[model samples]
Each structure stands twice: as structure tokens, then as C-alpha cells.
Target: MAEPILKWAGGKRQLLDELYARFPASYGRYHEPFVGGGALFFDLEPADAAINDANPRLIGFYERVRDEPEALIERLEAFDDPDADPDPSLPYHEETARGRDVESYYYQQRARFNRRPYEGAFDPLEEAALLLYLNRTCYNGLYRENADGGFNVPAGRYANPDWVQRDRIRRASDVLAEAAIRNDDFAYVLDAADPGDLVYFDPPYEPMSATASFNEYSADGFDREDQRRLLDVASELDEAGVRVVLSNSGVMYEPYADAGFRVETEDATRAINSDPDSRDAVDEIVATNVPPEDRGSAGQRELSGF
Candidate 1:
């Protein structure tokens, strides 16, 4: 199986079992609008699928991964030299190591990435490489943005940061080859999905609490309105007889229960919290119209006990 290439903020690796149990045995096609780490999409490796993200750069990165895996791999390998000079003075993995400052390198690349020639001119390959590198080295593997649309996540502490995985990249390329990748609003899935297809909406979730929010994946964070819009879309899909599954914060999504979707909560391990101490497990809402017969038994079994 192909693993997720990037360590995304709301990546669903921890919730894979729960998501999997809710998946239909089979469907006409697969649709994932908020393809972050794309944990479930990559796992299913569906032949006819459409994966999308609100972030254009993220979609561009996926394009590069699919179309130029070898070139991306070559560029990513050059970044493997974490700290060559060995600044024996700094503590191990603390800010600076070897003589080179890892944090400095991260910020420098971020500046380069934000520095567009004009408004939107950029080299896709380079941006993709920088995006991947920054995500791997950033705090909590988050790709956050500032109000000015700049990549602003601070550098993380990693003794030996490894962001280059040749086999994984190649595997992902194979999986994406047959899929239609797009950069668009989540609602685009509505026009593209058919009745028998499966649509999974893992939109940026509402925060568990004030201290637990990390929704700034873009300049304008996904707020209450976006959550409501997503619910509407999911409800539409459900009514169309499309298999609909959605995941969001446990707190604000009780409204989904009123929408007639089966709303359930499961403990999901989340690491993207401002307070490191609180980055443990939290209840996450998983609403779906998938029938119990269509869903696999294992995830239901594990979640029932959980």
C-alpha cells in the first residue's frame, strides 16, 4: 500500500480504521475533496477517482508528484543533508546542529517560496520541493499560512529529518495516474459525483477548543461558515443516493445529526494543537449515509469498543 507523502495537519492516518469501516464494499468512483495527507484515498487506490484540495499549491504539488516523480525525487534528495557543518556548540537537534542552522534554512526556503516574481509566477517543481521540505521540517508537520498568504509555520526539531522517500513517491504517482486531481472548492465534487459514487469530505474541522485550533491552512481559515457549507454539500450528496462520509470536529457538528445523516463520534489522535500537552486524543465526529451493510465490520468493531 502507498503511504501518505506529506505529514499534514489534519491527516487522517489515526482515523483510518474508523474511516475504513464506514467505506462501502465498492462504488462507482471515489471522491475526496479535502485531500490532505489523503490517507484514505491512498489506501483505497481507486482506479477512477477525483481528489481535490482548496489549496492550489497543494494540488500543484500533487501534479508534480504524479507527472514528475523522478525530477521531484532528485530535487528532494538534495535537501537530505540536514546539517553538514556540525555546529558542535548547539545541543543535539536543538535549533542548530552541525554548524548549519536548520531553522535558518527552513525560514530561508520559506522566504524564497513566498517570493513570487510577480503575483503568481512560480516554478512548479521548485515550489513542490520546497512545500514538501517545509512540511516535513515545520512544527507539527503543519503547512500553515499567514494573513498575507505566506508560508509561515516555524521550524521543528528533528535530529535526522528524512523527507525523501523514492518508493513512496513512485507508488503515489501510480495511484494518482488514473485520478482526476483538481484545485477547487469542495462543492465541485457535487457536479462530478454520480449516484453510486463514494464521496468523503474531511474538511478542515472546527476546533475542539480555543487552544486546539489549527485551521489556517490558507490565508482565510476555514471557519464556522465553511463548516456549514460542507454540511450542506454532504447532505446534498446523501440525498442524491451517493455514499457520503464526512469528518469534522466533535463540538460544532451536532447540527449534522439534525441533517438526518448518521452522526457518530470516535476518539481520534490529533497532534496539531498549540499546547503540546493537549495534543493527545479527542473525540471527532464522523457523519455518513453509508449503510451498515456496505461498511466493513472491523472499524465498526474497534470503534464500538472505543
Candidate 2:
């Protein structure tokens, strides 16, 4: 099975088992346009897949793993001493904040990540490690940034964090080797689907309440315009006979109802965030263009199991 490459803010790791139960027992090829944590991709282990994300760094990491897993592993191994302090405030922190040199910025970010309360600069590999490290250690594993694309989240309180999951990384690398990883706009992926292809989308949730919506997957946010574009894409894919399953905020269903799709609401609890008040269970939607035979089975199974 594949593991998630990044510790994403709103990853679907908890939903994978239930979601897979609803998928067609057999399908042609698997495609994940918004491949955040890739919980589903890893869990399903599809033979043919086109996994993609809008985050360039994420795509770069996956590509590197496919071509140079050992190198990435070595870098990760260097961070194994979780208690070792490496200076949290590095030069790249200021550089990234200023939108100066991104490569140098990332390197510095990694050094800070290695040292709790970071204090020095880092290299590219270390930066990647820091990214993963912060994701694992931050509040709810959420990755939020300022308008300028700098990493701005504060550290979380974890007594012990799995700084390096060597086995999981190796497994993830093996799983990714068989898939094609791409860094592109989500439409590029949706448009590439052929008939019989299965596409799973987990876009940023449309906010249910004014305070609930957050879209930091990329430096630029996915605004209402992006949502409309995604709905249009769903229409196109539905017409082409491609299986499409989506997860988003329940609030979006009212607007998306005209797209000829089915919508179901599920209860979800927030796992990443600093405030305990924001951790309560809330309603989320599962929208899909798949036929009835291919939908809702997993929901039923989950309810039955509970």
C-alpha cells in the first residue's frame, strides 16, 4: 500500500477505508486530481494511476521519490533524532516571508524544522524534511501560508512525533513508482481522463460557516470562480462517462445541485488545528457523478459497522 508523501491539512486518511468500500469493486484506471495526502491512492494501490496536485513542492517530492527514493530516505534518516535541537529560526524563513529566493528559502526552512524552535539555515532536502516535519508536528497537520506563499503556521505541542517513518516512506516510494505524478492545474487532470477512468477529487471545502472555509493548498486560494470551474469540469466528465467522486463542504451542494450529481452529507471531526473549539464533528458532503450502483455502498457499510 502507498503512504502519504506530505502531512496535509485536510487529508482523507480517515475516510479512505469507508470511501473505498463505495468505489466500484473493479475499475479501469485510478486518477486523483487533488492528491493531497493520497490516503485513497495508497490504500487502493491501483495498478494504473495518474496522481496529481497543484502544489509544486509536493509534486517535486513525489517525482524525486520515484527517481531517487534512496536520496530522500537518506535526508529523512538525518532527521531521526527527534529530540536534537537544530535552531528553528533560519534565514530562509525571512527569505520565504519576503518572497525572495524560494530555493534558498526552502533550505533555510528545513534547518529550522530540524531544530525545534528552529535557529539556522538548511539545504533543499532538509527543507523538504522540514516541510514534512512541520506538517506532522503542527496543529491538525494543517499547512497554512500568508498571501505571499510563506509558511506561517506556529509549532504544535507533541510530546513525541514520528519525525521519520522509514518503513512508511519506503512503502510510499514503492507505491508511487508505479504511478505518474504531475504538477498541474486540476483541470489538466480532469480533462485527461478517458472513458472508464475513475477520478477522485478532494478539493478545498467550500466554507459551511463564514469562519469554517480555508483554502491554502496553493499559495493562491481556490475561490468561488475555481469552484464553478470545477463544477463545469464535473459536468464534462460526467457526459464523457468517466466515474467522478468528490468531497467538499456540505454548503456547496445547494449551488452544485444543477450539475447532475448526487450529494450526501457525512459527519466529520477536525483533527488539525490549535483551538479545541474547532475540533467538533461537523457535516461534510460527498458529491459524485457515479451511478447509484457505484455510490453509497460504503456509507451503508460504515453505518452498519458502527
**lDDT per model vs. reference:** 0.78, 0.67
Compose the digit string of candidate 2's lDDT tens values, residues 1-306. 456666666667656654665566556788898887776777667789999888766676676667666776776655533334333443444343334433333334443543322333335555566667666655556777656555666555567766566666778778887898888888986568988788898888777787766787667888888888988888788888888888887788776566778777777776565786877776777777666676544332111110
Q: TM-score of predicted model 2?
A: 0.81
Residues 1-306, candidate 1: write the lDDT tens digits: 677888777778778778877888778889999998777787778889999998878898999999999999998887644334323342323332123334455655655566442245578998898888878777777788777777777778777777776887899999999899998999998899999899999888887788767788887778878888888888888888899988888985579889888888988877566577887888898888987888755441211110
lDDT of 1: 0.78
What are the TM-scores, per candidate, against the unseen true structure?
Answer: 0.87, 0.81
Candidate 1 clash pair list: 85-98, 85-99, 86-98, 86-99, 87-98, 87-99
Q: What is the lDDT of residue 65 in candidate 1?
A: 93
Q: What is the alpha-carbon lDDT for the whole of candidate 2?
A: 0.67
Q: What is the lDDT of residue 59 in candidate 2?
A: 72
